[model samples]
Target: MAESKDLLQVLWSGADVLRGKMDANEYKTYLLGLIFYKYLSDSYLAKVYDLLNDETPDDLQEAQKQYEEVMKTEDAKDLLQELRESMHYTLEPDMTYVSILNDAKGNSFNREKLQAAFNRIQESDELFNGLFADVDLYSNRLGTGDQKQSATIAEVIKVLDGADLIHAKGDVLGNAYEYLIGQFASETGKKAGEFYTPHGPAQILCRIAMTGQENKRGLQVYDPCMGSGSLMLSCRNYSTEPDYIKYYGQELMPSTYNLARMNMFLHRVHPENQHLRNGDTLDADWPTDEETEFDVVTMNPPYSAKWSAAEGFKQDERFMDYGGKLAPKSKADYAFLLHGFYHLKQTGTMAIVLPHGVLFRGAAEGTIRETLLKNGSIYAVIGLPANMFYNTSIPTCIVVLKKHREGRDVLFIDASNLYEKEKKQNVMNEEHIDKVLELYNNRKSVDKLAYLASYEDIKANDFNLNIPRYVDTSEEEDEVDIKALTNSIKETNKAIKESNTALVDMLNNLTFSSSETETAINEFIEILKEV
Candidate 1:
C-alpha cells in the first residue's frame, strides 16, 4: 500500500509540472496520454531485452543500451518483424521514451521526436489509430513560443520518467493511472462527469451486475455509456477468469472515447476483446451485428439527459418493447436504461445509476415503468447517499435488472444513510458498500434499511417503484415524556414568577436620576403588576 501511494505521488508530480499551463480538463489529456506513451516505450524495450538476451534487464536504460547495440547487427530486420508480430507495435531504439528522456536531461531534446513516436504507435495497429490525437505538443496552451512549449513538455516527461512503470508489480501501475484520473475528476468538478465515475459506485455497480457470473469463462461485458471504461474494467476484480473478460462500450465525446481507449491498453486488455465505439448511445443503436448481447451490462449515463425522443423511435427495437412508447424528451433516464437492458443476455444482470425521479415520474416514463415491472426486468433498487458524485450532488440509485427472473419481486436497499462526508463530497467507504451488498445478497427485509417487496406489494402502489413506499427510511421519532414535561413547565413558570417579582422590586427601589427615568420606572412597575 505504501508503494502504491509512492507511485501515485510520482505520477501526480507530472501533473504538477503542467498545473499552471492549462486546466485539468485539458492538461489531463497531455499528462495521461504521455504517461501511456512512456509505458508503451518502456514495455517495448523490456520485450526487446527479453527476446535478445533471454532475460529481462534491471532498468529501462539497460534495455535501451542493448537495443541500440542490436539495431547495428544484420539480424535487426528479423527482430523488428518478430516484435511487431508479438507486441502488435514496434518502437525503434532512438524513438524510445528512455532515449528521449536522455536527450531532455542533456538539454538537447527535440519535441518532434516524441510526436513522431506517438504517430508511430498510432500507425502500427488499428487499435491505436489516432490514439494520441488529443495530445497536441504544439498547442499554445503549453507555452508562448516553440522553445517554451517544448521545455514545458520536457519537464513533464522528466517528472514521469522517474516512475518505473515497467517494474511495478500487480496492478500498482494501473491503480496509479486510475488515481490520476480520479484526481483529475476532483479538479475538473462538473465537467468530470464526461469521463469519470466515482470509484465506490462504479465498484458496487459492477459487483452487483457480476454477482452470479463471476466464474463464467469468456464473460462478456458491455456499458452503453462507458466513461473512461472504468466501470466495465471493474468486472475483472470479481472474475475468476479476469483476462478472458471482453469489454464493449460506446461514448459520445471523441476525446473521452480516446481516453477510454487509452484506459483499455493501460489495463492490458487484448485488442481483439475490446469492441468500443465513439458514438452517441441513444442517437443510434451500436453492436447490432456482432455479439449484440452480453453477460453483464453496467452504465452511469448522464442523469436525465435530453434526447430526440422522436416519433420514429417508437419502432426502434431497443424501445419498441415498452408498449411502443418512448422516454420523454426532457428526461432520457428511461431511454438510457432501456438501451443497456436491450443488450443484456437472458441470464445477464444489468445495473445503471440514475436520479431518483425515474422511480416515481409520471407520463410517458410511467408507461415504460409499468412495462418493465410487468416483465420482471428490474431486480433491485439500491439508494445511494447524496453528493457521491463529482458533477451532481443529488442522490442517485442503482437499478439492477434481469431479463428473465422467477418473480417480479424487487429488493429495495435504502443505503441513503450509509456514507461519510469527505470535504465537499459524500463518499461510500467499504463498510457502507459491504452493508448494501449484504442486504442485496441476502434478499431479505431489514427493518428500515432494506425490504423485499413482492409483485403484489408493487401493484398495490400502482406499480410505483419509489423506495420510500416500501422501505421506510424515516427515523422513528423518540418517545415523549408527558409527566416530566408538565412538571418541567410548572417549575419554569414558578421560576419566572419569582424572577419577575424581584425585577419589579428592583425597579421600584431604584433612585430616579431624572424625571424621564422616574416616570419610566413607575409605568413599568404598574404594567408588571397588571401582567
Candidate 2:
C-alpha cells in the first residue's frame, strides 16, 4: 500500500506538471503513452535480468544476441521476446525514463532527443507502427512558445522520473492513467467523451457481462469497442475464476488503440492470448483466417456514428446470414450490434452499452432491433441513469444477449432510478452493480423495478427495447393520501397567515400606514413567487 501510495503521489505530481505545461486535450496521450512505455521497458528489463540470473550474459550485447537467437527457435514468439526486438520501440544505451530524467537535470533536456527516443520505441515494433499515432509530440498545441513546451516537457519528465511507477505493487499506474484520461475528458468538453468511458460505468458493464460466469467453468471475454481496455481489465480485476478467463478486444482510435494494447501488456495479458486490433470493427477484419467466435462479448461503440452501409454489405456474411439489411447510414449503433451478434459463438453470451435512441429509433435501427429481439436469445435490457459518463450526461442501456437461455422471457431492469450521485456525475456502486447482476442471474420479476417480458409482449410493443416500455419505470406518484395532503396544505396556509400577521404588527408598531404595509406585503409576495 505504501509503495502504491507513493506511486500515486508521483503520478499526481506528474499530472500537475503536465497540466501546467500542455493543453488539456493533448496531455492524455503524452502522459498515458509514457507510462505505458515505462511499463514495457521495465517489464522487458526484468525479463532480461531473470534470464541472466543463473548465468551472467557478460554485457548487453551478449544479452541481446542470446535473446534474439532464443526467440527465433521458440514456437511462440512470446511477448517478452517481441518486446526486446519489436519495431514499436528502440531502446538506446541510456534512454529509459529513469536514464533520460537523470541526464535532463544536468543540461536542458533535448526535446528532439526525447521525441526521437519515443519514435524509436514505437518503430522498434512494426506491430505498433501507429500505436502512438494520436500523440503529436511536436504539435504546437502544447504551446507556440518554444520555452513553454520545453518547460512542460521537462516538468513532465521530472515528475514522472521521481514517481515509482515501474513496480506493479498495485493498480497505481493504471488508476493514475485512468484518472488523467478522465481529467482530459472533462477538459475537452463534448469531443472528449468519445474516447473516454468512466471507470464506474465500465465496472457495471463488466459485472453485468460476467455475473453468473463466476461459477461457470470457462468464461472467455471480449470487447468490441475496447477504449483504453478498461472494461476488459475490470474483468481481470473482479473475476474469481482463474483459468477460464480470457480477454479480446478491438478499438478504432489509433492512440486509444495503443493505450488499450499497452494496458493489456501492463496487466500481463500475453500477446499470443490477446485479440486486440485498431480498425473499424463494423467492416469486419476479425483476427482469424476462419470464422472466429467468442464466449463473452462486451462493447460501447461510437454512438450513432455514420458509415457507408456499403452496397456490398447487404451481401456480406455477418448481416446477410441474419436475412436483415445493414442498419441505415443515419445510425451505426445497430451496425455495431450486428457485428457483435455475428461474432458471438453459438453457446456464448454478450452485453453491449448503447445509447437510448437504439431502443425506440425508427427505420433501419428498429428493423435490426426487431431481428435481435425475435431471435429469442435477448436476455435483458438494463436502463442506466443519466450523467453516468465522463462528459456526456445522456442516459444509456446495456443489452444482454445470449444464445442459450433457460427461460423464454427477456429480463428488463429499470436501473434508471438506482444511482449514487456525484457532484457532476452519477456512479453505480458495488451495491447497485450487485443488484443488477443479481436480477440478471436470478431472472425474476422485482415488482416494478425488474420484470420478465415475454417474447410476445416485446413483439406487441413494436420491438422497442426501452425500459419504460417493459419495466414500468413510472414512479406511480406514491399513491397520494388526499386527506393527509389536504390537512398539511391547511396547516401550511395557517402558518403563512400567522407569519404575515406578525410582520404586519411589527410594521404597525413602527407607525407604518395600512396602504404602505399592503404595498410592502404585495412586493414581498411577488419576490417570493419567483424565489
- Per-candidate clashes, comma-separated: 0, 13
RMSD of each: 1.2, 6.7
Give candidate 1 misplaced runs (Cα > 4 Å).
none
Q: What does the lDDT read for residue 211 in candidate 2? A: 61
- List pairs with backbone clashes in candidate 1: none
lDDT of each: 0.91, 0.70
Q: Model 1: which ten-residue window has the lowest total lDDT?
A: 166-175
Candidate 1's displacement at residue 317, Å, is 0.6
Off by over 4 Å in 2: 47-90, 133-135, 142-148, 215-219, 240-246, 288-291, 321-323, 404-407, 475-531
